[model samples]
Target chain A: MQRSLAARVAARTAALRLTNEKLYNEILERRKAERALRATERKYRGFFENSIEGAYQSTAEGQYLNVNPALARLYGYATTAEMMAAVGNIARDVYADPEMRLRFQEMIERDGKVRNLEYQVRQRTGEILWISESARVVRNRSGKIVCYEGTIRDITARKRAEDEAARLRQQMLQLQKMDAIGTLASGIAHDFNNILGGIMGYVELAQDDLPPGSGAESHLKEVWKAIHRAKQLVRQILAFSREAAPERRKVRLAMLVSEATRLLRATIPATVAIEEEILTETDEIIADPAQIHQVLVNLGTNASHAMSGRAGRLLLRLEHAAIGGKKPALKLSVRDTGHGIPPDILQRIFEPFFTTKGVHEGTGLGLSVVHGIVKSHGGEIRVESTPGAGTTFMIFLPLALEAPQ
Target chain B: MAHILVIEDDEHMRGSLAQTLERLGHRVTTAVDGKVGVASAAVAPPDLVITDLIMPEKEGLETIMELRQHQPSIRIIAMSGGGRLSNEDYLHLAKRFGAQFTLAKPFTRDELKAVLAQALAS
Candidate 1:
């Protein structure tokens, strides 16, 4: 019996040892799993903090819940917490247009996600910037949307570049249309000149047959003078369309203006006065002499026409101006005190064959020729006018690099 | 007064021009266009041929060339209202093509007389 009792004790001891060994193994396995899980958490945290693309999570109500440093820097903030504090109301404080945030939420709600949404947002400095965002709705365990996760890319520079390209394309199209009109104008002026030549010739022949003091001779002379004026009109159109390669040379603008205005002074009526103010330190430019002469005459003729049969004053002024600290330019101004051109008509003053004068008085090529000549010289022309207050036309031409002494 | 042939395309221009020349005391003959002018001048070869440069069937420039080829000694005066190239220097080419003188259309009776006088004196 004593022997049986000792065997039973040994069996019970063996059983207790087995249970302790099994419990120790289970604790060791649980410790290994905890270490592996810690490593995984560190890897995911590094990815969340260091990504260059702006990463963010926002509540369904558009409140920013979490934002990476890249996102903080994008809004011109030094830290993510500071940006979060300043931008409490995302719709009011972040987006330039509040409607954009509402659209973002509606998109994520309807589509379950939103990618590449373009929007304009205001920075902390009050500067507007364009951004492209990609995002998806974050859902709870029950599949209900709890927040939105998003990424942003600033695209302001690319948007500005596209806008400038469109503007240049529009300008190029306008220039091409003007060139077509010039070619057509040259063809018509040629035909008109020939017909006038016939009329003038016959009138001159008829005048020779009349006696020296006859009333018929006086009438023919008046008709002959009128024909000469029409011939001048045709000449203006020819000059505008000729595209005759300009003979470029050193041009003295002051002398040209002086000669033109002196001749103009004679033609101007007694009531209308002509004044000159030559104040330019640099008055020379490289251009075609004949074309510059034509520009001055054409501008002067327009000023005279604006005051015909009405009392007015014509002012011709010149000055040297340095534009934006670049090369010096000469500014020539033709100002007149007369009934100013109406706003609608002023826009079309440079169009070829567009005129308001009586049919026989003008062919409307005068201002068009002036504009063409100025452009050929690499110059710019602008006008300032107010109805009843008169008009002022300003011409800016680059000064010659080396003027002839 | 001289025997002159006027070759013009327009009938009214031809008639009035004929009257002007005849009133200036010259025996004048007329042709409706460049082709008839060349044909008429070839028949008799008038002393002075006043040919218009722009005409139907045969142009004035060609008419002048044909006249020079046929009647080398016939004095020629080329007149043009600038057919297709009014703005071009077409009148200068007329003199180069053997037209003794070139005149832009719509000339006074006195201007015509001077050219004829110069032609006659030469």
Candidate 2:
């Protein structure tokens, strides 16, 4: 009996030891699993906090639930908390065009995610930025969208670079076109002038042969007048095409402006009022006086035509301008109270042979000649027009350093 | 009346110039180009010469230089329809090359007469 009792005690002790070892091993395994889980969470959190790109989470109501530090600075905010507080309505406050938000939502709903969606967005400072976003919708068990998460990258620099390149290409094309036209105009001028000379010589001889007050003489006189008009047109073309350096002289710009204004008053309809204001203290510039006179006359003529025969006022003003740190320049502005240039035609106004006038009214070389003369003189010309109101042309010419000659 | 030589390449221009000079009470001789004009001038030595600048055989600048060297006292008038440069620019060059006066083609009768009178008076 004693031996049987001892064996039962030993077996019970072994069974208890075995149960304790199994329990301890289970506890150790659970602890290892908890540690690994904590490490994985920490790794993901580090990625989220330290990412260079902007990361964001927003609820379905366009309320930002969370935003990383990079996103705050991109939207011109001090901190992520400040950004979230200021941007309550993401569509209205953030998207440049609120409709873009709707489009984003629709696309994401259709495709479950969107990649590299580019758009313009408004910052807290009211400045604009181009941003590219990649986003996905977070859904619940029932497949209902609960929130949205995205990464955003600033793309404004790239957008500006692309725009600048396109503008440069356009400018190059325009210059090439002008060069070709100049070549063509000069080529034909020689033959055309010769032919015109021959015709004029014959007509004059015929007129001299006819008796005084004869009908034939009058008809030939009319033909001579027509030829004179043609001659003037050719001269304008030559002026535009000529690459010869101008005869520059140091002259007071005020004198030329006054002379051009006087001519303008005499030529344009008397009904259209002429207002002149010469406000510059120093008006001397080294330029070809004839070309400068032509510039003023052309600008004045263009202004008069803009009125289309309606009663209006043409204002010519010469003022002093201090342009940055460079040399002081004289500003000559020709303003008209008439129908303004439309936006579509404004960019092309300086191109040769571009005109809105009838065939008999204009040769379409006025502004182009003005442009050429200004460029040759190291000056700049700019135009500002409002569709219904009027137009103003501003010319900036560098003032001569020497005293009046 | 002054003796004049008119040199031009265009037939009508040459004819018309001769007629105008004759009407102005001057004896006129005509040539097709600068080469013919120089040969004619060397043969008879006219009192005055009106030459076109752009001609086939010889250009006006060279012809002006040759004639100026041949007879320093002879009066010369340069005319041009203009080529690559403007008529004014070419005419300015002609003046530099010893031509006494210059005319752009398609000039009026009055303009031609004025230059003619000026050249003769000086």
Candidate 3:
């Protein structure tokens, strides 16, 4: 009986030792698994920290759960801690357009991932940055979205390049307009020069044949004066065409108007009464004296023609005015008590070859040429009139001052 | 009285020029083109020749050059509408090739007469 009890004790001891050894081996295996998991997490953190592109992880509510250094720099912050502290709501501060964030959420929910989404983002410094993002939705085991993971790339340089290209297109259009004008001028000068030559030649030949102080000489003299007037018209055409240089000078507006009025009175019918009103002593203006005279004469002639076959008052007024607070200007107003311009026709008046006057009486280019001259001189002209009441034309020219050396 | 040849492509302008020259007490002949003018001049050389620069079949420059080669002393007056060859270089070229004077187109009748008279006297 003693030998059997000893054998049972020995077997029980062996069984207890075997159970302890099995437990120790199990603990070692678990520790090795934990170490491997920790190494994997450390590798992921290093990759996120050293990435050039912005890396971020956010909750479905747009709360930033984690952000890398690149993401903080992109948000105009010196450090990730400062960026996190300042921007609590990524939807409000980062997304320039709030709709973009909503769209991103919708895309992630529908596809479980969003790729290459472009948006304008506002940084901490209030500067706009163009960004493209590729993100994936982090979902729970139940398939509900919990967080978002994304990589961002700066695309501001690409956006600026597109804007610059658009500006260059506009500049090319302006250059084309100037080129067309140059071509037109060269064509017209050829034909006009021929007509003047014939007129001048005939006048000279007629003068030589008629002899001085003859009865025919007086009639010939009248024809010669007409030719001289035509010559002046040619000069104006050449100036308008930019083939001839305009003679520019400092002119007194009041004196110019008075002179024009006196000249008009001599040729105007007795039925047509002329009046003048000088309101400002500010008569100084820089312009071509002869060209301005032509403008005044054209306006006066137009007024006279409008009042033909009827008695009317032709009023010329001069005044001083300031424009844009930059410089003073001389304003000349020519008002006629004749038929006014129709509203529909008012816009068309400044267009070339658009005239209400009968053929041979008017070349629709008058107002168009006037507009061109005014634009070239950096001045402005306004026309105000009511149909049947009469028309008034006001011309504004910059006041002449001594140019800096 | 000097015999003058007027070469022009326009019939009306040629007729008018002929009338003016005849009125000036000179015998005048008209040709509507440079080739006809050249042939006419070659057949019967005139004391003076006035030619328009641009013409069909033959241009004025060629006519003047051919005429000059035939009769170097023949007084030549060139007229241009101030088109392609109106620049000083063209004028200089005309002078170099034996043209006595170059009158810009659309020149007054007086200017033409004066230039003609000067060319003839020289």
Q: Could you give the C-alpha RMSD of every candidate to the true structure, in order shown?
A: 18.2, 16.2, 22.9
Best by TM-score: 2
Report the poorest 10 consecutive residues by lDDT, candidate 3 chain A: A171-180
lDDT of 2 by residue, A1-405 (tens): 999999999999999999999999999998999998889888877887789999999987799999988999999999988998898899999999999999999998899899999999999999999999999999999998889999999999999967765664564455446646765786577667777877888898887798889988878978999999988888778778754457987899999998778777756787689999999779999998867987888798889888866889999999998544476899999999889999989976864445788976775567866876787677888999998789999999999986645
Which window of 10 residues has the lowest lDDT sum in candidate 2 chain B? B81-90
* Predicted complexes: DockQ each: 0.12, 0.29, 0.14
TM-score of chain B of each: 0.91, 0.97, 0.91
TM-score of each: 0.49, 0.58, 0.49
- Candidates arranged by lDDT, highest first: 2, 1, 3
Estimate, for each residue in A117-149, the C-alpha lDDT of model 3 and write its tens digit: 888999999999999999998888998777899
lDDT of 1 by residue, A1-405 (tens): 888999999999899889888888888888888878888878766777898888899888868999999888988899999999998888898999999888888888999888889899998898898999999997889999888898998999988866755654454355435445654765566456546655765675687679879988888888988887876776666556555456888888898788767656645576778889999767888988767866876777788777878889999998897644476889999999877899989976875456799876776667766776687688888888888868899988889887347
Residue pairs in collision within model 3: A194-B106, A197-B106, A197-B107, A197-B108, A201-B108, A201-B109, A201-B110
Each prediction's number of clashing residue pairs:
1, 0, 7
Better of 2 and 3 by DockQ: 2
- Model 1, first chain, TM-score of 0.54
